[model samples]
Target: MQILIAGASGFLGRRLVSHLRDAGHDVTPLVRRPPRPGEVRWDPTSGVLDATVVAAADAVINLAGAGVADKRWTSQYKQVLLDSRVDTTRTIARAIAAAPDKPRVLLNSSAVGYYGDTGDHAVDETAPAGEGFLADVCKVWEAATGPAEDAGTRVVLLRTGFPLDKDGGLLKPLYLQFRLFAGGPMGSGRQYLPWISLPDWLDAVGFLLERDVSGPVNLTGPEPVTNAEFSAALGRVLHRPSLLPVPGFALRAAVGEFGGEALASQRVLPGVLVREGFTFAHQTVEEALQQAVSSITQ
Candidate 1:
C-alpha cells in the first residue's frame, strides 16, 4: 500500500513510517520543512500542500496536531492547540477532496480526551462526547474531516489513548521522578487511564487501513486501569518503588487546565477494535511497560 502520513516527525508518526516500510509498503511522509528526497513538504497553516500526492495515496493518515500536554494551557497555547489540529486536518482533507484520484482510506487522529472525565464508567465509541475544553477541541478536531468524508473517502477517526513508551512519552517524565525516588500516583490515583502500547497502536492503524471500518474507533486497550494501578504497574516493570504521590492541588498548579485532564477519570474501551477482531500485541499495563523498557534500553 502507498501510505502518506502527515506529522511524520512526531512521536507516533515516525514509528508508523518505519513499521509500514519494514512491511514492504511505500510510505511517503508529508513534512513541514523543505522537501527531503522522498518526503513531501507542506505547511498546513500556510495552505501549502501537494494535492496530487494526497489524491494518489492508497491510504492517508493525518496525525498532524500540537501536543495537548506539551505546554502549560495558557490562553495563547489553547488557540495554538485548536489551530494546529483543526487547520492541519482541514488542509489535508481539502487536498484529498480536490485530488483527481482520492485515497481509499483516510485515518485521522483523535484522542480519548473526546470522552472527557468518564470517571469509572466504561466508554465505547457509542458514548456521547463528554464535557471540558479538550472535549470541545476533539469535537472540532474530528469534524474537520468532513471534506474528505463527503468526498467519498473512507475516513477513520483514531480516538487513541496514552501511548506507552519509555524514552519519549507520558512515561518519561514519571520515569525521571522515579529515578529521583519521587515516583508515585498523581492526584487521587483513582482516575482511570486508557492506554495502549506503541506496537498495538501501530498495528491497529495498519489493520484499520486494510479493513472496511469507518467512523470513530477507540484505539485503547481492553483493560483500563486507575491511576494508582498504572503507577504500581509501571514501578514494578521498572523495578522501582512506587510510594510517593503528587497531590491533586499540586498537579493542577503545575499544569493548569491540563491537570484537570491528567486527574480526570476516563476509562475508554477499544470496542470497535474488539468487534472488528483486531489482535492486540500488548494487553495489560505491566506487559506494555516491560516491553517498552526492554525495547528502548536495548
Candidate 2:
C-alpha cells in the first residue's frame, strides 16, 4: 500500500512513517519543505497541496497539528491550537475531495481529552463528548474531516491518549524532574492518565490502515493509571523515589486552564480497540514504562 503521511517529522508521525515503511508499505511524507529523497512537499498552511501527490496514495494519515500542551493556553495560543488542527485537517480534506483516486482511509488525529474530565468513568469511542477547551478543539478537529468523508473516504478519527515515549512528549518534563529526584504526582494525583506505548500506538494505526474501521477509535493502553500511579510507575522503572508532589495552584500558575484539564480526572479506556481484536504490546503501566525507559537509556 502507498501511504501519505502529513506532519511526518513529528513525534507520532515519525513513528507512524517508520511503522508503515517497516510493514512493507511505500511511505511518502508530505511536508512544507521541498520533496527530499522520499518526501513530498505540501503546504497545508497556505492550502497549496499537489493533488497528484495525495491522489496517488492508497491511504492518507493526517497528523499535522500544533501541540496542545506546547504552550500555555492564552487567547493567542488557544487560537493557534484551534487553527493548527482545524485548518490543516480542512486542507487535507479538500485535497482528498479533489483527488481523482481518493485514498481508501483518512486516519485523522484527535485526543482523549474529547471526553473532558470523565472522573472514574471509563470512556470508549461510543462515549459522548465532554465540555471545555480541549474537548471543543477535538470536536471541531474531528468535524473538519467531513469533506473527505463526504467524498467517500473512510475517515477514522483516532482519539489518541497520552503517548508514552521516553524520548519525548509528556515524559520529557517528567524524566528531567525524576532524574533530579523532584518528580512525583501533579496536583491531587487522582487524575487518570490514559496513555499508550509508542509500539501499540503504531500497531493500532497499522491495524486501522488494513481494516475497514472508521469513526472514533481510542488509541490508548488498556490499563489507565492515575497521575499518582503513573508517577510511581515511572519512578519505579527508573529506580528513583517519586516524592515531590506538585500542588494544583502551582500548576495553574504555570499552565492556566490547560493545567486544570491535565490535573482533572480522566479514566479513559481502549474499549473499542480491544473489542475490535487489537492486541496491545504493553498492557500494563509498569511494562509500558519499562519499555519507554529502556528506549530512552539505550
Q: How large is the C-alpha RMSD of every model relative to the true structure?
A: 1.1, 1.2
Best candidate per lDDT, number? 1
Candidate 1, residue 140: how far the Cα is off, in Å = 0.4
Best by TM-score: 1
Model 1 agreement with the true structure over 1-298: per-residue lDDT tens digits = 9999998889998898999999889999988777889998888988777889887789999998898889999999999999999998999899988999999999999998899899888989999999999899999999999999999999999998988887676887887787677899988899899989988999999899999999999988889999899999988876788889999999899889888778999999999999999998897888888887786556
Model 1, residue 104: displacement in angstroms?
0.2
Estimate TM-scores for all models: 0.97, 0.97
TM-score, candidate 2, is 0.97
Count of clashing pairs, candidate 2: 0
TM-score of 1: 0.97
lDDT of 2 by residue, 214-296 (tens): 89999999989999999999999888899899999999998888878888787888877888899899999889888888966
Give the Cα RMSD of candidate 2: 1.2
